[model samples]
Target: MKTILKNHRRKVTVYLGRRDFVDNSSTTEPIDGVVSITYRFGREEDEVMGINFSKEMQLVCREIPLKRDVKVTEMQERLLTKLGASAYPFSIDIPDNAPCSVQLFSDHSVKQ
Candidate 1:
């Protein structure tokens, strides 16, 4: 697993392999300019009378601006050329109090 420090900034490069893969004409809003990250936690309970007994919570919702004109690595450049993908670069500043990712198994064990 990789560890990222809190309050530190990390650079990420996003590569879209196909431009025509998404149908933008069907949507009223443009799908560019921002990157959003959301954390969801949910638990399933007994379903009674055809009602869903699942409980869910939105722990985090964050958005950062998608930037461009950044430099790419040599391997990324080669892959971009080979796959004909476009790259978008951005940096994320992890908040100091951001919660770490966690998963709970059916056995009641937790993993981080």
Candidate 2:
């Protein structure tokens, strides 16, 4: 799933669905599905200062459950189909001080 949030936004959106394997098997069951977000910051090197290093910190993590545990009523199925996707609705609050996604110093990366 891909989510885009403006600087003023405080929420993260996600889409959940079943993952099928190549053999027609499945990975995660929809009933116990969960969506998680991990916020991270890191640097590979500070070239101007001539420093070579790696550092990282995990600033936030959140997980939300899905509603597939119970059988979907006919009405619910119809509504979901009308939305045009089999994915479930999910969202999470972006915590205060959560860093914005960034990358620097070639080979470095940061994500929120």
Candidate 3:
């Protein structure tokens, strides 16, 4: 299994646009939105503090209704492509043994 330091933070990024937003494919000038999840994961013994971190992120999409399963699936597919099938099922995993921190960054900002 892969080993990572407990203090280290992992990043999961999803790029979305009108045409498509999955697998980090190329996009046009304007990107609809972007989402990033930061975390880490690995064996307890590998880490000095004995802990792991992880984050599961949904793929980018055209921003459809939440009730639409198709849209959700499409987005999920893209995320899986980046993270892999067994990486994350619904949420990221965090071990209780070690102290970890997760930080998220976004370019979108609101104007006062």
Per-prediction tally of clashes: 0, 0, 1
Q: Tell me, what's the RMSD of every candidate?
A: 16.8, 16.6, 14.7
**Candidate 1 TM-score to native:** 0.26
- State TM-scores per candidate: 0.26, 0.27, 0.20
As for TM-score, the candidate ahead, 1 or 3, is 1
- Per-residue lDDT, model 2, residue 88, is 44
lDDT string for model 1 (1-112, tens) is: 1112111122333342222222234332212222223233453232232332233345435453244455554544454454333333233333334334433343233334
What does the lDDT read for residue 57 in candidate 2?
A: 53
lDDT string for model 2 (1-112, tens) is: 1233212121222323322312213222222222333343564243345433255455445443455454554534443454433334343333445444433332244233
The per-model lDDT (C-alpha) reads 0.34, 0.36, 0.35
After superposition, which runs of candidate 3 have C-alpha atoms over 4 Å from their true positions? 1-12, 17-36, 41-76, 85-112
Off by over 4 Å in 2: 1-59, 68-86, 104-112
> Any runs in candidate 1 off by more than 4 Å, and if so which?
1-68, 71-82, 104-112
lDDT of 2 at 95: 43
